[model samples]
Every structure is written in C-alpha cells, then in structure tokens.
Target: MDLIVATSAPSLVLAAGERASIRFLEFFASAIRNPHTRRAYARAAGDFLAWCASAGVASITAVQPLHVAAWIELQTQTLSAPTVKLRLAAIRHLFDWLVTGQIVPHNPAASVRGPSHTAKKGKTPVLDASEARQLLDSIDVSTPIGLRDRALIALMVFSFARVGAALAMRVDDVYVQQRRLWVRLREKGGKAHAMPCHHTLEAYLHDYLDQTGLRDEPKGPLFRTITRGTGQLSKTPLPQANAYAMVRRRAVAAGIDTPIGNHTFRATGITTYLKNGGTLENAAVMANHASTRTTQFYDRRCDDISLDEVERILL
Candidate 1:
C-alpha cells in the first residue's frame, strides 16, 4: 500500500500509511514465545534500521542484495561472522514482513548469504591444584571482606558457576542438610540448577554467613558489598560487570599468568574434572551445556596432543 518516510537523527523511519507495519511489528514482538529471542530480534532489527540509514537505502523496499552484501562486508571487518549473519537475518525478516503487507514488491535481499564465521577454537586457561590453592591463599580470610571473597572463589570453583549465576543467588537459595551444603543456581535462560557445595565451600560459606550475620531472608541478595562504617551489606544483586571485575582483580592479586576472567573458573573446572577421569557428558551436564560438542571445545586445555596416540600403541 502506501509508504511514508520519516527522518530521525540516527535512523530513517519508514512507515506504512495505514500503520500496518508498525502494528505488525508490535504483534510480532508480543507473539514471540521466548523473551530472550524476542529481545535479541528487537536489537537486531534496530541495528539493521541504523545500517539502512548509513547505507543510503531510503526505504525497506529500496534495499537490494548489494546493499545487504555491503552491510555484511562492513560488518566482517568489525564484528564476528556470526554477529554479521544475525544482522542479515534480522533485515531479511523485516523485508519478509514488508512483502506480506505488500509494502514492498519483493524481498530483494532474500537470497543474500550470511557471513561465514566459525566458532572460536582456542585453548582454555586452567588452574592446577597448586594454582587453585595459591589463588585461595591469596585472600586474607581474617577480614570480613576477605572472608567473603574466599567463600566466593571457593563457591565458584566448586560449583563451576558462571559468576552471574553465583551472584544472583539469594540467602535462601543455600541449604544445609546432613552435614552437606547445597547452592541453588539461577542459570542462563532462566534454568534452575542445584549443585552440592564441597566441604571447602561449605566451610568458607559457614564462616562468611556467620561473620556477616545473614538472616533467613528468602528474597535479599546472598552476596553483597560490605559497608565500611556501619558494617552493613547492601541487598542489591551484583551486576555482571562487577562479577567480572572481581575475578580479574583477584587474578592480579594472585599473580596468575594465564588470562583470567570469570569464565576461567568454568574452564578450569571442566579441565580439572576431565583430567581427574570425569567424562565429557558429565562435564556438559555440570556446565549446563545443551550439547556434548560444546564440552568438546574445552578439551583444548590439555597441552599434549600425543595423548591421543593411546589407540595406536594398544596391543
């Protein structure tokens, strides 16, 4: 039907005269089954709109295969191939909707190929038993904050938690029974996982809780920043950036050689378990990976490739 072009500073807003496309977009947003997917789609669409303005494609209908290709080429230099592919898919979706509404004659970039980006295949960092001990020992557990930091490191290592999941735990998420402690994790994609707290984690957590005077509050954050003056700890959950910063700061203090971040615990946990005869499937389940292949990527942490020669030398 009818097309109306509107201008914004960073975006060229193209509207359907009857408000059909806007309504369609709203409906699409509401109809999506998964909120995470819907949010990603919304971000991708927004980025595509900005790209369209930069490319001088005045309207969605005017966008061609070359325009799409040029965008992909531009993205290749700056973003990973997977990200570029996702951007293209987002643009394709908008054109598909335009075609359905008859706002465009055809989906011009319908057959455009996405950027070929492979997953990063790299060695994961690991802390041997000595290094893990050194890292724990680096924390001065005598002070209140130091005690909490020790408990945090022990909990992360034992549970193999993504730091975000660990930080999101509430006091009630931890339970003690029959001399064993357990931590309930709110994992990625809103999945809930229960992991047993090892003896070390239990001891540290016990000391931390007793020292901090955490009560039986089910909703307040489990991990909090300790105030200096009143000795008060905020109930607000720590952000992911803060989680990462904590890990990096501790790594520096411990004088770790390998590049370390919050993920180092996860990688080190998987590698350590595998070296100690734990199976790939078990690690995958422990890490909450959807596939065994994702766990396979962690095998690169082993320095020696010659270990695979076992079959050739077999009797």
Candidate 2:
C-alpha cells in the first residue's frame, strides 16, 4: 500500500490528518474497482501531489487552479495529449472525491481543461486480410504452444475481444451452444460478453483443447504460459506483456512488415468485417463498446479507400 502512505504525506495533509488519509486511500481502494484504472489513476495522482509538495505547496487543500494548470502545462511538453488528458482526469476525480468527503473545500482541477484531442482512427497497427491469414497459417501446430497461440490469436480476431478479456478467460468460457462453439469474454467494467466463434476460431480452439487436454479442467485458465524446457502449459494465465511479445514473434516469423500488437487482431477483424458489408452498430455490439463512436476508431476502411485514391494520380 504505497498509495496508503501517499495519503499521509505533506501533499495530502489537511486539518484532520487521519480522516483525510482514510478518505484518500478509500478513493483508490474502494472507489475504483478496475485494477488497470486504479493503478493508472493512482500513479497520476501520486505524481501530481509529489510535484506539488516539491513546489512547496503546504497541503492538499491549498492546491489551486493555477497549480493544476501549471502542472498540466509541464506535462503537455513530455506526454502525449491522451496521456496528459487521462492524468488530468485522474486528478479531477480524486479532488472531486475529496471535496465530497469534506477533505477539501472545492475541486481545484474542476476549471482546468486539458489539451483538446479527437481521434477518428486508433493507432493500433492492423493486418490486412491476406497477412492475417498468412500469420495464422504459418504457425507450426505440431507443438501444444503453437496450437495455443493460434487459438488465442483467432479468438481475439474473430470475437473482437480485447487482449485483457481474452487472457482472462477460463476453460469453461468456451462452451458448445446449439452445436456451435461460443466464447464468453469478461470485458472491462466487469461486462460479460458471449459471442459465437467463427468457424476458423472454432477449429483452432478444438485442436488446442483436444491436443492439450485442457477440456478436462473446465475451471483452469483458457490461455496459459509455457513452462521452459518442458514446453508444457502452466496453470497460471498468460500475462498481457507475454502475449504481446508472442504476437511480435509470430508476426516476424510470418514475414509481416507491419508492427502489430495484441490489439491489432481486434482492429483487423473489425475492419475486415466492415469492409464485407457489416454495420457499424453491429460491430459496436460485438466489440462491446458503449458507443459506436469508439467502434468507429477501429474501422480503418477509409485507409484502404484513401490509398486507392492516391494511386489514381497519373503523371
């Protein structure tokens, strides 16, 4: 609980020390349930408070809009707009919580506006349909690791699942429903999304489960780390960093020029679907996005159309 200790520092000190500290800790430990968001927000809040302390700010209550704006200005120089915006949000939310608890008189960050940013397309590098097929076909499925990798990649691409949700799956999440293979994903915000598997994904999953005998352990992790030397799957679930590394290695082996990440498959699938007459609303539903606007970021059909138009310039 470094975050707990952070609450007691001079940056957070107020008239009632214990009460203020308790509220600060509760903001992270209780108010935010998502581990990823909790960690990120905690880092942003802690860094901002530490900077304030170094600047000779006596207490959290003394923090003013000027202090917040100055800190944000400095952050803009080094961090991207999105990163700075998220940090600002983290500070705004913490102060709002403190104000509600009577730890502070008002939210200093309330009036501050972060750098404006609007994105119509996501930055995640996507594979063309041919490259995607090549990557999947290039895997040597003789080994259990190969089968697992192929299945995991296909699951993300087909279901439009986030890497976090795909790795969080359990053996039982893949189930037979009405004679078709279906996957249940526990997406962000504790959302449960169930999608019928694409036929290719169905085949890959069947081979992986049957060959590895993971079907017997229905409660075990769906995707697992490999034990070095043994080449056997470990009981622990595959970590996101490890999955990213694996994706990079597979892309290289398949001779893919685009530098792809775990999110690439999701974007690739969405783009392919939309190009093949799929609706944006339907893609949003499948991707579990709260809004179609977020889904539109993953729709990169315009990139292809733009390239086609660019080739029309004849000298």
Candidate 3:
C-alpha cells in the first residue's frame, strides 16, 4: 500500500491484547522510534511496575485508579510537575491498553488528571558561546579518552543532538562521503534523519575516531569508556546516565556555576541560533521537529511578551 496516513488519524486496529503491555515494552526497545519518548515511557513503566511490586499488586490487571492516584500523590512529594505529569500519562496509557485488550471494561485511569507543568522561567540553564568554549577548553585532549570526550561534547553542541541520540549513535552511522560528514539519527516516530555535520564538529570527530582506532569497526558503538565494566561501554554505547554525569563533570571542571546537564546543549543550541537570526523554518528543519511550534518551544530567548506582534495599531 502506497497510502500515507496522517499521524493524527488512527491507522492500526486494536484488539484484545493484540498489543500486550509486555509487547509494548518490546515495541519501544526494538523499534527505531523517538528516542526521547522511548526513554521516558520506559522509565515511567519501570516505576509503575516497581510500585506495583512494592504495594503487593500481583498483576497489571490488578492496578486501579486508587492505586494510580496514590502513586501520583506520593510522587508529588519529590517529583517535579513535569515528571508527575509524565508518570500519570504513562499510567493512563497502561489502563487504556487494558481497556482496549478487554481486560477491563473501562480505563479507571482515563478520568485521572496529570499535574500542570509550567514553562521554564527565569534564565533556564544554557551555555553561551564563550561558556561553551571555556567548557571545551577545560578538557585536556592529550589522552585518548579526553580526546573522545572532547569530540563527543563538540558533536553534541554542534548537532543539537539529544543525549540519547548521541549515546545511541554507532560508528557506522557517520557517513563521510561527498566531501562532507553526515550523521544518521533515529528520531521520534521511528523516522531516520540524516543531518549534515558542521565542519567544526567533523574535524574533532576525525581526530577522536583516529585516536580511538574506531575506523575499522564501523558497526561498533560510537562512544565507549576507557575503564571497562559490565555496565560501562564495553561494546554498547554509553548508558544514558553516564552521559548526564559526563556533562556535569565537565561543567564542574570548567568552574561553571550554572546548572548543566544533557539538555543544556540542546536548549543552548536552539536559543543561540534563534537569537542570531536563525529562522523558525531553519530551526524546525535542523531540529527535525514535526512543527514549527515545537521548535519555538525550545527557542526561549526571553523576548518580551508584547501584544504589538498580534495587536492592530490602527483603530
């Protein structure tokens, strides 16, 4: 079939347990879907299952709205609003699945509401060009591991890649043909996007690849750890948690007081480019957003919320 169905429209038919909860988890792992969404959903599901086990709930079918409500209430004590909302959404999805599978007559969680998340206020953490330079300069690229880390940071900033994408990257994914470097990313919705590498990042990548002797193993993981461990990057790309730790370590090493994490790079890239006159269309295309509004959400440049942009001057 050559037909292209819009995402808003339902294309796949749902029957009793045809898409089981366990199978849904597998769907996330195997499918080259939205890496961010996959990670979030995986974490949410894991938390729910852990809570169920601790609460003496024997099965997914045993979960009810009261249990979910209590979980949300407990989570509110420590979790941020966004985190609470995401968990609620995950639970809602689980019940929706149950209803669709005919395990439940109705979704108990369908009527439950999620926490209200506010837009980030007051100078969200982002690196300026100078700060980013200082951060990169703080790394001593003399050693092999240092060089690899430097390249990783450079590629992440230049590419505006989500930490998961960087961690998920494989050596074979980088194509250096036609006198330019391109990276293949499995983005949201299982869509593959090949973005042209900035020339600056390409140089760092070349040096890092050579130092790591990664040229021969094109199919191997892109990032690895110098110290080998069961959980360390023995062969797989570095774990997501390690990626966050790396950013934090680097920021502290640079003597930066600002809060730093994986997302700082992405937010910085979008805001910096937009402030420098990068159009919404260009940002949308580069960020691989399905809509410009999504791109705008990342470009938090602190513009005054003026009515002039929408108001009529003539009466």
Candidate 4:
C-alpha cells in the first residue's frame, strides 16, 4: 500500500465524515515519522476497522472499548503476544490521535488491555565463532558480487550494523579516520553511529572497493544489486529482502543448517563479543541500544552453558 497521504480513507473512517477521514489519515501521515512503523500501524488499524465494520459498527466514532478488547482477544488467539500487543497499540494510538483532534469522544482502546508477555532472550538465531569464520572464508571474492556480499556480511559481523543501516550506506560512509577505516551507520530513530573497522573487515572492504572500483564513486550506494547478466554491481541499493536471500543462500552453500536471517549476524556479533570479554555497556553502545537491558536480550552466553549442563545428565 502507498503512504497514508496517498491512500484512500478506510470505509469505516469514511462513514464518519470528511473531518474524521482527514484526521485518520493525518494520524499516519503526520503523527508517525517512521515509514516501517507507519506501515505496520496502518495495517493494524485497517484490520481492526474492517473487523469492526463486519461486526455492525457504523463509523470510526462508533468503536468502543468492548470492540477493542474483543478484537485484541481474537488477535491473541492467532498471533504471538508481542505482535498482538503491537497491533493493539496501533489502534490505541490511532484512537488517541482522534480524541485529541476532537474527531472522537474518547480513546476506546485506552482502557482495553492486551495479553501479558515477557521476553528474557531474543529469538534471533546466532552462528558460533567457528561457523561465522567458515561462512566468511567460504565466500569466493574473485567477482564483484562476491566481493560486495562479503563486505556486507563482514560489516554486520564486525561492526554490528543492522541490515537497514548497512544498506542505507553510501560509498563515502566508509572513510579513513586517523589511518583507520571507520563505518558510519544511520541507525533507528535517525541516530548516526560510527565504529572502527575490525582488521578482517577492513581487508575485505578494501578488496571490495579497490577491485570493484566503488572507491571512485563515493556518492553511489555501498551495497548494490548485480547487473542481470554481467554479475557486476548496479547503482541501485540492495533491498533488505534481497540481502536476506543472499545470506540464506550463502549459509546453505556453506553447509550451515540452522535457520538464519539478516538479524542473525547482529546477535552473533554481540554474543561473540560478550563471550570474548567485551563489556555489556560497551556492547550496548556498539549496538546503538539506549539501554543495557535491551542489550541483555542478545546476550546468549548462557545458551552454551545450559547445553553443556544438559549433556552431563546423559541417559
């Protein structure tokens, strides 16, 4: 779907009035700045409104706390608790906006409660140090695609760049500072983070830039799509989906059976760093997390310990 500004008003919203339609659209268009968050919220709002309409609700204003609670209950039955909570939050926020604008009388979702959940560990899969090394070493960097893929993967492993930040990079984002290579990443909430390159990452990046001739075009995208037949880098920035596919394909080629995604590298990097004596505060800073509590989720050091203990109780 297009951005909220370009999209038509929902049927339930349209039934309210022109004012309600504009206010609803503005909630997504002006209230939310992040496109990804806006998309998720828009989807949640749409689903809820459609469900309300099917259940005999006449307009956006007619939605009540009971309707919100019922829908959240239904969501919990089909989706994970966190996802259901997020969806509820979207409706809650939308209603909050409508209330403030005087489009609605009150926030219906405000009083409704979502299901309870807690997470002590993140669900992202991580590669062990040896598996990570094997995957990197297995790549054949004789060609530009290989070189680009290697550099991208190394960027995530070494500097812990999120795939979005890594892909958003321009060639100039990689620069020499005091004779050491550093990468500048635009992280979430528009934060800019920079980290010095790990020695191996530095070598791989230099190889990619020098051999692929990307060094000459500093304004071009850092990670790019390959030309259809030539196997050469195109100017287009590689999308996150393509990057995910590349990693999956690479992992399979390297004989890694564990299911992995783009986020695997970030968690793997954090876990490996902590296992090698890196501080939690420093790891939090490196990952650009605002709190160490958030960083703790990625700390999977106990996983190995737990497995070893379990092995000792052999049948």
Best by TM-score: 4
Pull out the clashing pairs in model 3.
34-188
**Clashes per candidate, residues 3 or more apart or on different chains:** 0, 0, 1, 0
Off by over 4 Å in 4: 1-7
Question: For model 4, what is the alpha-carbon lDDT of residue 165?
Answer: 96
Least well predicted 10-residue stretch by lDDT in candidate 3:
7-16
Per-residue CA lDDT of candidate 4, range 1-315, in tens? 234524578889888877888889888889998888999999999999999999999999999999999999999888999999999999989999999999999999999988999999999999999999999998999999999989999999999899999999999999999999999999999999999999999999999999999989999999999999999999899999999999999999999998999999999999999999999999999999999999999899999999999999968
Q: lDDT tens string, model 3, 1-315?
A: 112212211221122233444344444555425566666866776677678668877665566777778888888999998889987876677556557656666776777777777663424477877898899889987776677778888777788777667777889888877889988877655567777888878988888788777888898989887665432235556777887788899899899988888878877777778888889898888887888877777776664234445565666
Rank by TM-score (best first):
4, 2, 1, 3
Per-residue lDDT, model 3, residue 35, is 61
**Model 2 misplaced regions, further than 4 Å:** 1-16
lDDT tens digits, residue span 181-207, model 2: 999999999999999999999999999
Lowest lDDT 10-residue stretch of candidate 2? 7-16
For candidate 2, the TM-score is 0.94
Q: How much does each candidate deviate from the true structure in C-alpha RMSD?
A: 5.7, 2.1, 9.5, 2.0
Ranking by lDDT: 4, 2, 1, 3
